[model samples]
Target: MKITVDLDPKLVWQIQSEAARRDLTPGAVLRERLVSSRNTLELENRIRSRVMSGMCDADIAADLRLVVGTIAAVRRRLGLRPNRRKPGWAA
Candidate 1:
């Protein structure tokens, strides 16, 4: 599958750098990224659909926050702590 695309120079550079670091070509990097992005979008769409189908916003928010917190806690337990601030900072 060969296709032409008009990509931003900065993004192209980043992709190229990542490809080099990973010993892969730009095409492979792009394909992997596309697949991952598509999966994430699909998951988000499914969640949104569920949320829109008579689910309470507070309950949904609480469930999502709990999941996120659990993931963070697991990461910390596994020594993979992220470098972000606590969840509720003034944006």
Candidate 2:
């Protein structure tokens, strides 16, 4: 599909540099990024739904840690509480 959209200059430069390093065209790099982002979004949605449905906190924490090691820090920074508390920490 042919499409045109304005992009940040810094982002464009980074994309071009990466494409050159990988010997891929800018379009191919963008396509790969888009596909990766789509899969990540789908996976995150599935995980979030499970978490919201009362899935065990340890399991969710493990999954998040595996996917993004800084997730806990980010959550804390955002003041977002976990859906479940660990054992022995119950109030």
Q: Give the candidate number with the greatest lDDT.
A: 2
- The Cα RMSD in angstroms, rounded to one decimal, for candidate 1 relative to the true structure is 11.1
Give per-residue CA lDDT, model 1, range 1-91, as digits (tens). 6899999999999999999999999999999999999976665654455344533333434555546554344344444424443345322
TM-score of each: 0.62, 0.66
For model 1, the superposed segments whose C-alpha errors exceed 4 Å read 56-91
Model 2, range 18-80, lDDT digits (tens) per residue?
999999999999889999989866756655664566544455556555533344443444444
Cα RMSD to native, each candidate?
11.1, 4.7
Q: Which residue pairs overlap in candidate 1's backbone?
A: none
Backbone atom clashes (below 3 Å) for every candidate? 0, 0
Give the number of the best model, judged by TM-score.
2
